[model samples]
Target: MSDPIETAIFEKLAKADPKSVGGKSIEPSDVAKELQPEQWQRMLPKVKAVALGLMRQGKLTITKKGKAVDPNSFKGVIRLRLPTEAETAAALAALPPVVEDDDDFA
Candidate 1:
């Protein structure tokens, strides 16, 4: 159910190569630029928003100075990465079940 931008952010972060960035993390700008080469500059804010939301959900980790920061107070530069298996599992467990709507107009 992710929108294009959210999908793009995760795709970019998931495919990040550790050797290239010293770790499996990438800058928000990287995702923005890949989604819109020419107008990439405008995508930075959206990228951060998705990243922060994911971090709040525990599916992602946002870091500053190689340590996890409080999403509510983070500022300046940041890096995004997928959480470890255990962390992801915990996050998944915490999420409410998705209930599909089944309205009928008979």
Candidate 2:
């Protein structure tokens, strides 16, 4: 089963209209906004788990450049490439369609 926090992030990313690659790394605000206080509390561990999983899979990498990249600093920002149209279409196609009365889930 998909972790709910990761699912929340995915859903946020899926709906986002990313306008720029620079500035702040896509703030977690959008996803955070979707969750209630209780939901966010429950989601923290799952978010960490998903991040660790991505790190283990080598999808997320930490670059080192002593001093230039301090772990404590938040300035070392990198942009994430949003999927291409074809990729987005393929992703959307991979999902099962929403049933007529399934708006709540979809």
lDDT winner among the candidates?
Answer: 1
Candidate no. 1 TM-score? 0.71
In model 2, the runs with Cα more than 4 Å from the true position are 17-25, 38-49, 58-106
**Lowest lDDT block of 10, candidate 1:** 14-23
Q: Best by TM-score, which number?
A: 1
**Tens-digit per-residue lDDT, 1-106, candidate 2:** 9766566655554455345221123334334446656566465445545533433333322222311121134343222223444434544564567777646754
Separately for all candidates shown, the number of backbone clashes (residues 3 or more apart, or on different chains) is 0, 0
Q: Write the per-residue lDDT of candidate 1 for residues 50-99, one digit (tens) a residue.
A: 88888778778788888777777989999987777665666667678899
**C-alpha lDDT of all candidate models, in order:** 0.79, 0.41
**How far does residue 38 in candidate 2 sit from its true spot (Å)?**
6.1
How does residue 67 of candidate 2 score in lDDT?
15
